[model samples]
Target: MRANSKEQIIEAAGVVFERYGFKKTTMDDIAYAAGKGKSSLYYYFKNKEEVFEAVVAHEAEHLVNEINASINVSKPAVEKLRSYVNIRMKRFVQRGNLATALNDNFLATFSFIEKIRNNYRDIEIDMIGEIIKEGIEKNEFKPVDTNFIAEAILTCMIGFEVPLLTKSNATDESVEKINNVIDMFFYGICT
Candidate 1:
């Protein structure tokens, strides 16, 4: 199949998969959703799983690129980490389905989504570890378990998004709470 055809199917699949969800959606559903025939879908994707993976992978790549670009190596470690959190939350809003799938239902099962999530997460963690290394070099962030600290910060960022999708824009109070949590991550609450 042509590159454009494959991309169209993936784009269509993203909308259909999110609208109908991963389980209820079928190949015919995606084909019809794409305005193409079932054979065309099959020509591009072997199964529903392949289409879903393509959609998720596309979102993941987009997010990684956005976050990576926003990270400034020149900044202080904590400042870099702060920008990382803000950029990540913005992407969470933009990613829509993969974010919803990872944070919401998706047939109430997330092993497949979790695997995809970890693939993206590992990069963020690695980038954070690099910042930690930089901090250690400059005597900024304490020289502790960088990997564990990175994991903690990443978890906090994901936690911030967990409730926002369900609200009419989660309240200022909720945003305040999550920001407080994130701030504690960058700097200890006590001066």
Candidate 2:
């Protein structure tokens, strides 16, 4: 077995956790996956919880980086918001470990999971709020409470997670539904 780096351990642990979940997974499983001894795992992390936290943090950081990159384009605020929604939804599904960590009720047993989720939630709200503020300043969108609208959009996103994860073929139909919802958010229902 190679001398596994901490990142390697975390990456391996993510796979193990995704396969067996937080409770069912053990240090041995992570070690085997990382091609390291169980003792080597301890050198980097105190326990499975620490490893799992690292994995979640890694995934969350990756998601934030992608979101920031996608939204930093020269497009209008409306396009930035649309890009945010598309990337967030797409990545949320594609990143299995993060999705499992956030969506699985069982993982809620880890208290840190809630903290990580709350941190991500706050970041999401702030980013959306900025986009809304930009939209209002440019008169691309009507003046509204940015925080309220951001929170509302986040709530809708949270509502979409479970159903999207459950469906066997969710991508196309889900994207259409999400776009429809965005259009409704932009345009009034009275039409």
Best by lDDT: 2
Q: Total backbone clashes of model 2?
A: 0
TM-scores, all candidates, are: 0.83, 0.92
**CA RMSD per model (angstroms):** 2.6, 2.3
For model 2, the run of ten residues with the poorest summed lDDT: 1-10
Instruction: Please report how far candidate 2 places residue 29 from its true position, in Å.
Output: 1.0
Error of 1 at 189 (Å): 2.3
Q: After superposing candidate 2, which stretches have Cα over 4 Å from the reference?
A: 1-4
Q: What lDDT tens digits, residue by residue, belong to model 2 across residues 84-155?
A: 988888876674778877887877888988987888889999999999998999899999989998998888
Q: Give one digit per residue, the lDDT tens place, for model 1 in 1-191.
A: 58888889899899988787788899998998788999998887888877888898887777777767767546777676666666667666554666866675543374666677678679879987887788888898667898998888778777767665556355454546656886776677898
Error of 2 at 89 (Å): 1.1
Worst 10 residues of 1 by lDDT: 166-175
